[model samples]
Target: MVTAAIGLEFVKQFLNLNNPPEFVFACCRDPATATDLKEIVKSNSSVIIVELDVTKQESVEKAKSHVASIVGTKGLNLLINNSGLINSQRIGDVTREDMLKCYEVNAIGPLMVAQAFLPLLRQAAGQQSSEPMSCSKAAIINISSGVASITENSSGGMYPSRASKAALNMITSNLSLDLKTDGILCTAINPGWVKTEMGGPNALITTEESVEGIMSVLEKLKGEEDSGRFYHGVKGQTIPW
Candidate 1:
């Protein structure tokens, strides 16, 4: 719901395309909380909401099946591994379970989604109509964080959040290399400090602004240019590993 409400809204308004791209929102909770999303589906029949627990492989597979049924064999053109969790605990305060939970959602979740959806992404890349202008390339965007960049203890706590994002960046880079031949582009984006529930009240940007910036990055994506790079949202620059 958050992705659809914040991320896709920016994509829809900023892109200004003739038609809105179909969207599938996968969540672990009940879809009823997404009242705004439900309204979007009412207006645009192409939107789908499915139950998905990214931490579990079974849940991911079920969600994939549901999406496949909706979009048919054409498959997904874009996959955004945006689902994540943050546990704010200092090094000594952090527990083993907390660290594991963070890794499950932020690192392993994206990897599972990528592996499960590879065929769909490949299908989208190979899609060609009798008219060449109708085809579109496939892409994957993984939401990473600035914590992944530095090893400093400036933040004090939040070890789980920091480590998971770093792991996510590594996953993104590896996936990009593996999927390059298949014409699937994968890149990690640090969406900057935005005032989401996770970003807290002192965040620098609004969720809308951050999403707009990320969408700008997404729009400029070209097959030859940025596939495996780590993007910094605020400066719109690439971050080196």
Candidate 2:
């Protein structure tokens, strides 16, 4: 899991699971600065805070190495690309810097992280003899947004955020196909208009509500049957690309 507003909720929910993960790497750009994240997981020995900057390849590789060292032959089972950046600028106000930065963080970052962690994901998948593709074996979940849906777009604005997230949706689809042979499932999930710094206080749902819905959808994901799909986290409904 990654550490952010919604990412923190995921960590909490995962911890509360009846059968919690053996270890949850609460990754963030700077562990030293993530006071809230640190405080919540301090008492739990299983939650390990990792320093990871998704936008930087060096940082991604470093985090991968650290995780690989710890997980050893067991390898990693699940990777949630929960890191994101939002640029709310409209077409007239959006700049090249805004567009590029959002694209780098929201679209390219997940791809880079997945590339760096492919060996571990493959290692975990290879360990599963003839078992079906599942998160327990290996899976990549990209946290996307509903605004990325081109088909569902009614009001047009937020050029950077919309475009970058749309690109992310495409990346998720490609990853699903590319990693299918390795039995790795990849999917993009829209956590809905949650009440977070990004989502704003006027958002439709709470972080708990959004994560609960996301967890429900994730729990039901199956092999190729569910791969490469865009989902509404709150409703568990498919969204058009």
TM-score of 2: 0.97
TM-scores for all candidates?
0.87, 0.97
lDDT tens digits, residues 1-241, model 1? 2253345455345335565575544343456776765676676655566777787788889877877767677877888888778788887899999999999988998899888878787878777322121114787788888877764336567889988888999999898888777777889998888787777889898877787788777777776458888997666889866
Q: Alpha-carbon error at 137 in model 1, in Å?
A: 0.9
Clashes of 1: 0
Q: Which numbered prediction scores highest in lDDT against the true structure?
A: 2
Model 2 agreement with the true structure over 107-223: per-residue lDDT tens digits = 999989999999999999999948888888899999999889999999999899999999999999999999999999899999999899988889999999999999999999977
lDDT of 1: 0.73
Runs in model 1 deviating more than 4 A are: 1-16, 22-28, 128-136, 151-156
At residue 9, what lDDT does model 1 achieve?
Answer: 58
lDDT of 2: 0.91
Model 2 bad stretches (over 4 Å): none
